[model samples]
Target: MGRPKYFTPNEVSLHSTLGDLWVSYLGKVYNLTPLVEEYKGDVLLKPIIECAGKDISHWFDPKTKDILTHVDPLSGCVKYYTPRGRFVHVPPPCPRTDWCNDFGRPWWKDNRYEVCSEETLDEILKRYLHYNSHAHSYTWKHNGVSLDMSKTLSENGIPDEDEEFFDARMDRDLFSLSICLYFNDDLTEF
Candidate 1:
């Protein structure tokens, strides 16, 4: 069978949407099922893989057993790996919030901040690869997806250097998914 083609990383909604899907920030659904109640980045995969019913397991994870450790390759977050099946969540915000790595300058400046561990990096890269080639514009996807104009830069809050950085998130900061979360999927066996 042919591989699935994804919308290009240009699609802000799609990029942001799928990025969130890979690592949700809100909360997990009640039980577990592919009928994910969370929009994106809602800890859907791990819960579904760990506590979900048997129906949708195959589509998400079957033999994978633990899903929390599963992260998107392109998401660019990482942490230490433990045998307990516990994996770390490594979205950009985590490094900044928890590790204080994002205090000054854009994240691209520091190698330490980029250290999402070797394994975790590989995983995120693989997931990101799923959409690198596909031609779709994130710019169009972000349009009115769930935008709030009032909260964009506060009277040109974007500095000259920072503008380029923030702009990458959404179309002109309109849909900046600046805040996101990761999952601690139940990869470990009890």
Candidate 2:
């Protein structure tokens, strides 16, 4: 019962693999655990293919930066608001570090968002990867009775050997501002 993604018990069911559906979905070569397998269809590949019309490593980040500025599907608006007021969208992998929304922080005292942006393929891709069971967290806050998205992928896990490369790219930013950025879902994407 969320925006964009309408999932109820009747539309889909994953608890029972229904024969070898789960095992077969993940080929033996991947050696993928259940954590990664369940999301491959409904959350991962389906969106990727739907977006770029290809299954390439679109999830993988490059040395360059990507920009995004999508409109709000719910409000039909194209502006972002925070403690700092409104702003425009940037592409993939925003290097913004000044965002102050800390509710999505891993160390936050309490989470409050039910879902983030999933209006378009790009937004969905970013949130889906970050919201996975392992790589990122589904944070929330309450605007009255409504759940607000605190989707974040700022800090987690071990860094690659090339620490400088990752450092220059990620900017060590948190998910206070729900902008379009490359969610660090390395484990799930692979």
Candidate 3:
């Protein structure tokens, strides 16, 4: 009934303390303070401890084996449980390259796009337009709509070169320009 709220990573960081735990997953922010308090003594705390106040998109990614599992201290039974909370939409961090595109092609082989460190939003836009125009082999869609990458980027404001915009779009399940410098190649080697 009200306007949706958004928070920057810095804002989420303000609530990172254990007493006021908050974490971001898939561009959604969740306050896990209550769950942490409830499961204080459970082994489930391990994953939570690792992800508190951080963007946990990778944890939920299908390609990765980063699931949260807990062991019952008394019975030695292992189980998995995710924290429950009132999650708000926030821009998520960039995803891993392997998870960026549907195609099994390596990033370099796909387009050889290199996100420049000093690249402006305009530069990114130009690259997107070029990619969309020339690369017809792959079609990127959001909510079943074939994305007009240029139109979407322009509509969102072209001057925004901050990493936040990229993260936000990814979180919203929008288009992914995994070609950006924000997602470095330091991850798993191809």
Best by lDDT: 3
The global C-alpha lDDT for each of the candidates, from Candidate 1 onward, is 0.28, 0.28, 0.47
TM-score of 3: 0.35
Candidate 3 lDDT: 0.47
lDDT per residue as tens, model 3, 98-129: 33233354221222222112233344445555
Which should have the higher TM-score, number 1 or number 2? 2
Give one digit per residue, the lDDT tens place, for model 2 in 1-190.
Answer: 7454422222222322322121111001111123224334433223322222111112222333221234666767643222222211211223367644432432111122121222433344454665654423322322222222333122122122223434455432221333333334344431
- Stretches of candidate 1 off by over 4 Å are 15-190
True-structure Cα RMSD, model 3: 18.9
User: If scored against the real structure, what TM-score would every candidate get?
Assistant: 0.15, 0.15, 0.35
Instruction: Indicate the worst ten consecutive residues by lDDT in candidate 1.
Output: 24-33
Q: List the pairs of residues colliding in candidate 3.
A: none
Alpha-carbon runs more than 4 Å astray in model 3: 62-190
What's the true lDDT of residue 18 in model 3?
Answer: 67
